[model samples]
Target: MYAFEYKRPASLAEAAQLLSGDDEAKLVAGGQTFIPTLKQRLAQPSTVIDLGAIGELAGIREEAGGVTIGAMTRHGQVASNDVVRRVIPSLAGMAEVIGDPQVRNLGTLGGSIANNDPAADYPGALLALQATIRTNKREIAADDFLTGMFDTALEADEIIKEVHFKKPDVGHYEKFRNPASRYAIVGAYVTRYGGTVRVAITGAGACAHRWSAAESALGGNFAADAVAGLTVDAGDLNSDIHASADYRAHLVKVMTQRAVKACA
Candidate 1:
């Protein structure tokens, strides 16, 4: 990694101040992606502000008729937290399979969502569950927070505080992951809130997005057969060596069907 000054702030205010003062500074939550990029010489920030020392940024709480997860909360904590498992077990399950132990233990929810990796698991969950992302500046809807691949709506000085997720009546996630990286090639998160059904898809496009057609069909009949005739457009999807756009589109339907069935 290129030489850079590192700061581990003890409080959120301090971190925000440091970030705002230095335009070339970068924030590190778990350093899962940023650290690797630094080592590869892809990013050379003058300062690396670490959020790990901010105790208030990490925790799991049950509130607001759902669950509020602190931004710096680690994947393994989310996966194993009793409150998370009880309130949104499917979300916990998604976290459980995000990556191998090392990644799971090191990656943070805030970093994952803020980075907005198309193949990341949390984006799909946030979109499907209708989450509210609370930052140091303002509250942004999950749909508005994730813009595109490796992008978010966060400002240069903004810091995510917590994510509040609406507890769905029923929810499940399924994915066809790349074996080596364990990143989703095509993943689907299905959720039903009373009569409204939401289907969020990931790893198939530039960003995680909802599958409206499937939601409409599933809202009418929450079953696998309801989506049997449904198909996702492959033109806009990612076509990497791991899977073609068409294949990922196909997996979208298959995974959605499987997730819905799992919810049942």
Candidate 2:
């Protein structure tokens, strides 16, 4: 990796200022993605703004209406949080399956969401849970936050501070992952709240996308059999060495059904 100036900011404001000052500066929360990019020479940033010293960017807050997870909160924390498990078990389950112990201990929710990897677990849960991405500039709905593969709606220098997830009536996540990498080959999250239903799929397309047909069918009837007749085309799905686009499409339905069963 090329030499780069590193700045450890003690506060969110300072981190934001440093990021705003240098266009080529990258934010380093957990460094799982950034470190790899640096090692591969895929990114040559002039500066690296480390947010580890920013205490404001860590922790989990449970409220009556919902829960707010600080951006820099690590996956291990989320996976084991008793409060998170009680309130949003699906999210806990998703977090628990995020990588091996070392990666989970180091990977932060903010980093994962910011990277916007197509196979990342957080995006599907975010979309299905109707979560909100709270950034330094504004709060964006999960549906609007993700753009495409490795892309988001965040502007330059914008840093995510927290994510808010609504309390659903019931929800569950099921992922068929690439065993070696632990990245999703195909994943599904199904959430039911009041009379509404949402089904989100990841690791299958350009990005995590909601299954409108499944949602519509399942919304009308929250049952595993509700989605049996529905199908998604493999035309735009991802095809990697781990799994074909068609295979990923098949997994999407299977995972969705499993998620529904788990939710039930």
In order of listing, the candidates' clash counts read 0, 0
Highest lDDT, which number? 1
Q: RMSDs, each prediction? A: 0.7, 0.8
Per-prediction TM-score to the true structure, in the order listed: 0.99, 0.98
Tens digits of per-residue lDDT for model 2 on 1-264?
A: 999999999999999999999989999999987899999999999999998999989999897667899999999999999889989888988999998889999999999989999999998888998999999889999999999999999999899999999889899989998889999899998999987999999999998999999998998899999999988899999997899889988898999999999988
lDDT score, residue 24, model 2?
Answer: 92
Local accuracy of candidate 1 as per-residue lDDT tens digits, 1-264: 899999999999999999999999999999898899999999999999999999989999999879999999999999999999999999999999998888989899999998999999999999999999999889999989888888899998999999999999999999888999999999999999998999999999999999999999999999999999987899999998999989998999999999999999
TM-score of decoy 1: 0.99
Residue pairs with backbone overlap in model 2: none
lDDT of each: 0.94, 0.92
